[model samples]
Target: MAQDADDAVDCGMTVGLYGRLRPYPWTGGEGGADDGGEELRERLVNLALSRAEAYDWYAPAGLRMRGGRSAHPVPDRWFLCDQGGADWTVGEDETGPARELLWMRADLPRRIASARLPLLPMTRTASDALHRAGDFRLAALRAHLPLHVTAGEADGDWEDMRDWFSLAAPAPTVTVRCAVAVSGEETTPPAWRSGGTAAEVGAVWQTLLGEAVTVAPGAPPATSAAGGGVRYRPYLEPARPVAAYRCRVREWTADAAVWLLETAGEALRRTGHRVPVELTAALA
Candidate 1:
């Protein structure tokens, strides 16, 4: 179960504190059962909110990409990260009931006062209600997420994800900037991996990006088929594989990605790309 959630994490958001909760718990070698219904949903959601409160930051990359950001044609999976630790997969087989969960972030006081730092959860009914009938703050939190977009599924324990927002339609004559498929050895990173402060992650991301730009200073031969760009596969623990994020949110991820791709790859010897660059150092 935890392994499955790990796979989903690489589908979008890369490193940091991330988690996924199944409606019901799972038994050994068996899939998740929806033994609990709305009552269970309420329990799980409450757990998620508590978890969100513990983290100081939340990245909405996938929430926007899938929910409609054209640059990210391949929609990223739903995930929440606090910029420390590995992915948090909640289930009977994994971390049992959110109560017993151990996270990478330290329990500290809020650093940003008078700021909307917590990622609150909003019910589907509430979001669709007449005039979003609920706390006014929910409207503000909508920009970020934890948008309670849970839905029923036959495979309850599996990576059951639903859209948090309805995406807008794209123009008929639209142009795609890039398309990619990440294929490599995928595995769940240990809890101790990349357990650094958000600042540490930022510094590493920026430094590596600077070097990557120098390595591939020239542009690749133009291609309408859509190819070329650095890919980062973060190894949370020493030489351990943290899944590649399926998100293309741009900006926040750009520099961090370069760092994980080149520097982390060489150091860990665990990252690679579908497109070969040895023939040429690389191209921007």
Candidate 2:
């Protein structure tokens, strides 16, 4: 297994830890022009951009893979791409083979049940319907903004216009959590199979809720001409936005138990932006 140091070398780990590990820190305060959530978001954007530049696959194709890569360099653009579509499998029940669209560790169901988090069983088709309906309804609420784009291409100009943003009638927020024991084995859930074994599958949960933070034209501070904003707007399909709050691992073993939080103290201290709340939903 890769140690924390080794994992830190991976592209995903770096993107995920970007702003949260900076020296200046973002502690949610009032000071020079470099304090607050806007700065925090900008810091994250810069870090992500650097990583994206380093990795070739992380461009348009990687962005499109699995509905675009998470922790993208351009915050607004990544946000739009993610919020653009709810990609799902259609008519899989009758003809398509049983698929693992979004599989959680088997044990996760029980843990979440005990923790008392809301959950909804989702199929790919069902998730897509929710995504489509949600986007359509949200656009209608603010029809003046022209947020909706053509089927194939994105709404280029209006993509960064935050003035026309609106919330959904029924915003669904599904959070999934699962625990799996690590073993040195090849057989396990795909997510864990590569580096470790799934000794045990723990409880999992999924639910929907309303309330999210979105970027706007003037809301988030503007970027300098040095970093092109070409990547700061929605350029994908099925715009569905989801936020992440917290994701960590708790290891329980014979000798000791440990809880590893995924944030760097320096980053949070500098920006004053408490880590974002864990906000995520399944695409079914």
Candidate 3:
């Protein structure tokens, strides 16, 4: 989605968005006594440096935090940072949580993503999107470059990446459509309750394919450099990577895990448009 506001053509560059939001009664230091403001700021700075993928767009103006204090004058159109990575924007006041939008474009052109339109944030929600866009895979194939992909820290991605990069495989594409809903006061499945505690601004989803989805009930409210704060849900574990072509796209809710947006979008868009229906997701 690196195109200008009007152009939908994605020449294989990527734009990813991740969010960080905590309800009032905010308890800031989740990272023990060491989780002070300076340490947090350094983390965000280093993360932006890695995620920015360039010095030009970042060097001149550098990063800022929306509604967060500033030393010098804030840049006109700054890319801000937080626990969930960096975001590209006009630095609008956070409508909800502090979300970061990440853009990763390669030094050279690979292939135009077959998506007729530039992809959306929701389309690129899977964990892999955190590394690269699906279009880049196809672009590699079309450009005749060897396509190399990595799995997640967890096994989900390892299994997902087993597919052949080209469209000429026994089953070239795999997609997961998650129907996430707010768990509400209705007890989250016993397995999903956090030490019998529930979370706020919480989002939950079940595979539309009739599979079980469980949040990391006892995993505690975990904070990560990659994902702000997450309640793990082991949903995308692929039984076998080469099993299907038909994908039922996931539905998104406003309250869902903003970081998971990358995982969700990457999961669905991994299809590389080989299937009849090129699966996609939207913020709405």
In every candidate, how many clashes are there?
4, 45, 16
Per lDDT, the best of the predicted structures is: 3
Cα lDDT for residue 20, candidate 1: 30
User: Model 2's lDDT to the true fold?
Assistant: 0.19
lDDT of each: 0.23, 0.19, 0.25
Q: Model 1, which residues run further than 4 Å from truth?
A: 1-34, 54-206, 209-284
In order of appearance, the predictions have TM-scores of 0.18, 0.19, 0.22
Better of 2 and 3 by TM-score: 3
Deviation from native of the Cα of residue 12 in model 1, angstroms: 15
Report the C-alpha displacement of residue 7, candidate 1, in angstroms.
38
TM-score, candidate 1, is: 0.18
Best model number under TM-score: 3
lDDT of 3: 0.25
What is the lDDT, from 0 to 100, of the residue 104 in candidate 3? 28
Candidate 1 local lDDT, 1-284, one digit each (tens): 24322123222112111123332233121232233333333433344434434442333333333334222211222234332211123344553222211121111112111111121221221122211211111100001111112112222211111111112122222111211112233332232132432234334333333322212112222221122232222222123222211222222121222222333222121121211111111122
Residue 255 CA displacement from its true place in model 3, Å: 16
- Stretches > 4 Å off in candidate 3: 1-11, 18-100, 107-284
Ranking by TM-score: 3, 2, 1
Clashing residue pairs found in predicted model 1: 11-246, 12-245, 12-246, 193-236
Per-residue lDDT over 9-55 for candidate 2, one digit per residue giving the tens place of the 0 to 100 score: 11100011000011132333123234353443344334433443344
